[model samples]
Target chain A: MSKELIRLRDLVMEFDGERILDSINLYINDHEFLTLLGPSGCGKTTTLRLIGGFLKATSGEVLFDGQEIGDVPPYKRQVNTVFQRYALFPHLDVFDNIAFGLRVAKVPKAEINERVHEMLGIVGLRGYENRRIDALSGGQQQRVAIARALVNRPKVLLLDEPLGALDLRLRKDMQNELKRIQQALGITFVYVTHDQEEALSMSDTVVVMDKGRIQQIGKPEDIYNEPKNAFVADFIGESNILDGVMLEDYKVRFFGRTFQCVDKGFERNEPVDVVIRPEDIDIVPASEGHLVGTVTAITFKGLNYDIIVEFRGFKWLIQSTDHCAVGSTIGIRLNPEDIHIMHKSEYSGMFGDYSSYSAEYDELTEDAGDEEE
Target chain B: MKKNNAILLSTPYILWMLAFTLIPLGVVAYYAVTDPVTGAFTLDNLAQLRLYMPVLGRSVGYSIVSAIICLLLGYPVAYYIAHRGKVAQKMLYMLVMLPMCMSFLLRTLAWKGLLDDTGIINNFLGLLGLPTLRMVRTPGAVIMGMVYNYLPYMILPLYSTIVKIDRRLIEAAEDLGCTPVQVFQKVTLPLSMPGIFTGITMVFVPAVSTFYISQKLGSADTSLIGDVIERFFKGNNMNLGAALSLVLMVLVFVCTGIMNRFGDDEEGGVVV
Candidate 1:
């Protein structure tokens, strides 16, 4: 097994008597690009701050390579952080900003110059050593911030939405750059972001969090396809959740139809929530498909169209290249293997009971199949 | 369209400025150079320049010393106010600026009463069975009065500038392995320079021209250029007063220029 670079065991953090990070237990392997994905106020940034030693945990221990660092000050921790605002020193030029920590350590001037130049090259900013941070573009400033943090050569680098300030195009560019840098340096990267797409595109492990609790932790594909809970399914991306009963070990029904889901945890006739990703669904020929629905609306989305199909009384948002006009009668098929089922929570609010949903869907599917004939 | 509208709107302000400001300055300039005996351009009044030169130098010296005194005393107070929590910071600043609402002359008179040989301070000291030291009618009292009168000017600007400085910069400095002292030296001091420069200008210019504070707080020997100008204008020698005013105005310009040069293009700091 790969040795864990950083481990947070039962780490609980609080602010003003309210818990911010509730009993967080996460272990990051060496050189893993682990992303903590959450919406704003989900305590992801607080998690990063805890790892960076900027804030103290209320209870629990943070271990770096097996040593407890409960009371370590920020400078003493073997970690560095890149803040969202790119908190670069305004008085220093690009080179000096990168060399700040080294100079503080009283490293020789010749060595400082060498390291600064090396960092400049690493961030693809070789000739920008003399440039003022303000003079550079947002993308350039972000690169400088990264280089500054990385130059310290910490065991783990915590980036608190470091690309949040950059525009969409630049954010995408930096996402790829960060991934490449993580691989090249072989250092643990704990990135925090509200953008699920950014986390999915770049991270080796994505930890979905909600309100100081972990929803799921898995690889990108698994988190997208095999989300373990209702919150994880809903938070990571768009999903059509239809509440139904788990009729048997492998069968589940929603929106007046039984969908063959491949999950095993359920008693017979127990209520279960069914999750179907929009992309996993398609408008198919009515004779050969699993479930059917009529097109309520169809809108263009660059390469493909967002097709909103009505099933039973509920609606299923289907993404496809098929062009279906609004109010068109269209038969739909939800791929069986794509379905996910989970235990219900009172806090999980979306679809109601599924018996009525199935009845409504069957009526719409029958109408669409007749239209196709 | 925007440019035309801006220029048109600025016309009234420009006219008011030129009428009240530029014309009076022109009148002062004419009087400063006009020959008193010949009624033509001559050095007749200029011959009396040496008589006022020492007083002018004294004014410069007093303003510099008092401004430095205010700066040293006000910096820590302003920094303390800027760093306190929201409620405490506001309350402290309110107390610091409370003196501004009171009449300046009343406050000066109160200081006079407090500093007198038989005043409350001396009485209190005597009650403590301690020697009542002489304080009033001295240069020290004058400097004290000047500092008290203009302290708010030196503090509020410094407080505003210090408050805007990002606390994260200091935290970042500490994170880079700098001690608390190094953090202040590397981050806090440089970031607060703009406020310091502004505070200096605010205190220095007023202290140099303030004659009333010196007259009330010090002996006749401590008279400043403002006192001389007041005497000349009162004696109906407006020309001499105008000449002194012109000299004071030039000194203000020279001092401000020196200060601006020192603080120009301050990093992470507002210059104006």
Candidate 2:
């Protein structure tokens, strides 16, 4: 394992007597692409700011290479940030903006030119040196922002939703481009983004946060397939969560049926939450399937059909390539290893409500309403 | 019918512009190029402006000095006010605008009264057993009047523009290895160019052409082109006064053009 280059110990941040980041500890290894992923208002940006030395911790230590850097100002720290709005200096052209840090350091003019050109090439904005910041499109401006930060060549690059302003196509393209750049440079990147797909696709380690606290920290697959609680499962992707009971060892009971799962170490008759990915559950014939339910809705998703089935007053979202008619009874089969069981979490009861599904159901019914015409 | 109604509704505004703006300018232009009595075109009135060269030079010098002083003083005050919280910002803005609500003539007269030998300030100095130096009718007093009366124009524009700057740029600069002073010099100063241009124009235009402040506060030795123009306009020399006014207008245009070039045009070029 790599050495820890940045460490946050029991970090707490408060604004106006209200907590923004609660007591928390995190470590980022050197040359690792770690991403802080969460929804809005989840304090991911605050955590990144603390690490970037832009914000002082209310009570805790921010250690860089085992040295406390809480009192260090942002300029003196070995970290740079690409702000959420790109924040490219409107007063300077693209070349000067990318060379800002080097110029402030009084770097030789010849060297600043070479490095700035190199950064422009890296961001694929070679001919945009003289372009005014406001004249460029949003994606082009974002590239300039990235080039400006990366030109500093700091030990850690903190990006705060850098691609949030781009459209879907550009966001996807930049996601791959960012991954390629990070890999080539091998710099420690602590990226903050609310887009789960962005985090899953690029991060070496994903730190899932919620309400000023970390919910889970693991690889993308672990976070997606083995979320420790309901919130993580819900936040990361679509999960069909069910209230269930663990019947000791690997046996779990849900929907009036006991099923075998890979999870163990639960006491007999223990209350638990069960999560199964929509794509994990396979669609079999009604007679051959383990569970039977009536299909309430179906929508074409190009790659797969997103079908919602109601079983025992609970809706299950399943992605299948086969065509299934609405209001027809269908059967779903779950593999033993696909059933993820965990102890009840704070968000377990808050989710899985029919009212929460009202919007999607309304859209589905609207299509049906249109079909009837 | 709707468009016609809209055009008819704007008729009063058109008439107002013609009466207050266009007619006065036409009259000035006519007087500037023609002899007041003979109604014959002449360049003699324009050439006669050279006789008041010393007064014109003094006007330019004093306006430059006042603009520089306002900039040096107003920039820091505006920077401080921009960083203040919302409530304090509103209260301080109200305080800055309070003096502007009073009449300019009255304010200049109040300064004249305060600077006189037997006025409140001199009396206070007398009670302190200090010498009451001569300042009532001097170029220094006139410059002081200019600075005091036009300082608001400088402060307001500077404050508004500085506060509108995206604060994240400063933070990003610092994050990229800029010290606090470097951040200010690189980010804050360059971004505040628009305000500087606006403030300089706002302060310099009135300071350059101010007649009452010079008349009320300065000696005859410190007479500016404004005083010369006022004298001609009052003493039956309308053509010459009109020519001098045109010269001042040209000077104002050249200075504004220079300021506009120096400012960051992408953000805000001219406040007006």
Candidate 3:
């Protein structure tokens, strides 16, 4: 009767004394599309392996349907994994390959044939029953791998960057295809990828990780618009982080000026990083302004112009519909609703004691915290 | 490859085949169908083919039996070596080759001594109060020599084949719910067919043409084709010898063709 499908409790994984995954705790809800997003070697694949029962956890327990499966081999588990290489059996034709698991389970021959055809139809490989695996194109082969995994009707599916070997265009198209499949089946899906755009577009919950730790877990919009720490804000999308202090409950200071921001959860005078998305900062005419600055450069970004402005030894990359040429003075205004104030813990690591990381950022936020004084 | 350049690239190998294999067979052919005194065609030698065909048949039958034994014994040894660690593999490979360092005559002599009527095995049988076994100068001795001479030939190729197969293919089968036995049946055996084919051809073809192993171990009554060919050549019957030689060459070609046609393409794996 429980809705939770998988629970990973404080999992720790180490291989030969090298810690790959450190104390990971999470739960996967039924029918949710979740993504484990991180850079390479951040233990995303290790986590998936632990859940699939391929690798045993050092300390934690993985419960599927309220049953502990720490000692079970991968085949006995109800979860199935699609490897990056597609791992198709080359000797078996398309139909035999899909029927492999069913036959192994001692299913009746007639039923095995029926399920195999049904699976092939589901994966859009209806007519490729007799094709050799090596003879099929890369895209068609991927479909067989999917059908092979789904034929047994696993309760959850884990894909370890299955599209990593695909070309960019094919990978993008498969991303949408995977989403469609998950929606149709209503099965819990755990996808792992380092591509930020792919994670944001397809995942219901994006769990961002770094350096063997979970940084944040939230909806895609919250992770993008309101990052909790400097790491999350920077990793999710580009943000112009500025050093600032909370002047009052409703106001913050940056760029030698005070601006009213909607984020208000700190004592007075706490150090913060102000995040304003490129689209949030408007490029107004020079006469009307919250702050006036000179445009250092302009870049054409297909639909709009990215205007780089300098003021008070700070620079901001603002995107706007009203075009501004390089070397022109411009007025800039930060929309309070779009202002994301982050704590200083995240940016300290980036700056290496806050200098080398942001010499570029220093020019962008030269007047930080002056509005309060 | 383009047609012109493909032929150009193959010229050296083609010429080499022509000189060594085709040229000798051509001479044998010419002599098999000719009268030495008149350079005229005669069935005199061809008419004697019926007399030697039975010996040819026995040789083929004997070789197939010995090769089967070689395969059955060699397969497990090759599989163990291929799956062994790097150091173990090298050591086992060297052990297999050590017997080859001595001349084939020496190895066959040792086998003859062991299987003689009053030899070590018969003496042991007498001591055990069992009937003194008959082993030497019989069909068994010829088979023993065939298997011993070519055991390494069978092992080496089969080991290399099994070692090169993609282990992931086997793992994929097991992961797809195959019991270990089913995995071997569906994946390992099919993948290692090429290695079995290699070992069989390497052993059987040479064993059929073998004269020394048979003569040393078998009785005079065993009329194998190898002994017949040996007698015709050594006894000054050149016409009969040339005819038998041509027959053996054709058999080799036919066997090689079968191997090329049905050898395991997935032999990129270890001999399981």
For model 3, report DockQ.
0.39
Worst 10-residue lDDT window for candidate 1 chain A reads A364-373
**Residue pairs with clashing backbones, model 1:** A255-A357, A255-A358, A256-A357, A256-A358, A256-A359, A257-A358, A312-A360, A312-A361
Query: On residues A27-58, what C-alpha lDDT tens digit does candidate 2 reach at each position?
Result: 99999999998877888989988888878889
Candidate numbers sorted by lDDT from highest down:
2, 1, 3
Give the 10-residue window scoring lowest on summed lDDT in candidate 2 chain A: A364-373
True contacts kept of 2: 0.95
lDDT of each: 0.81, 0.89, 0.80
lDDT of 1 at B210: 89
Cα lDDT tens digits for candidate 3, A119-216 = 89888999899999999988888888888888888788888777776777998888888899999988788988877788899999999887677888
Task: Report the C-alpha displacement of residue B143, candidate 3, in angstroms.
Answer: 3.6
- Residues B1-272, candidate 1: write the lDDT tens digits: 99999999999999998999999999888888786555577555556767989888888888889989999999998999999999998998899899999999999989999999998899999999999978998888988999999999889988988998887677666666677777778778887888899898889988899899888888887899999999988997877788888888988888888887776765323222
Q: State the lDDT at A21 in candidate 1.
A: 83
Per-candidate TM equals: 0.90, 0.95, 0.84
**Backbone Cα, N, C clashes tallied per candidate:** 8, 0, 13
- Compute the lDDT of residue A161 as modeled in candidate 1: 85
Chain B TM-score against the true chain B, each candidate: 0.92, 0.93, 0.88
Rate residue A304 of model 3 by lDDT.
Answer: 82
Instruction: List pairs with backbone clashes in candidate 2.
Output: none
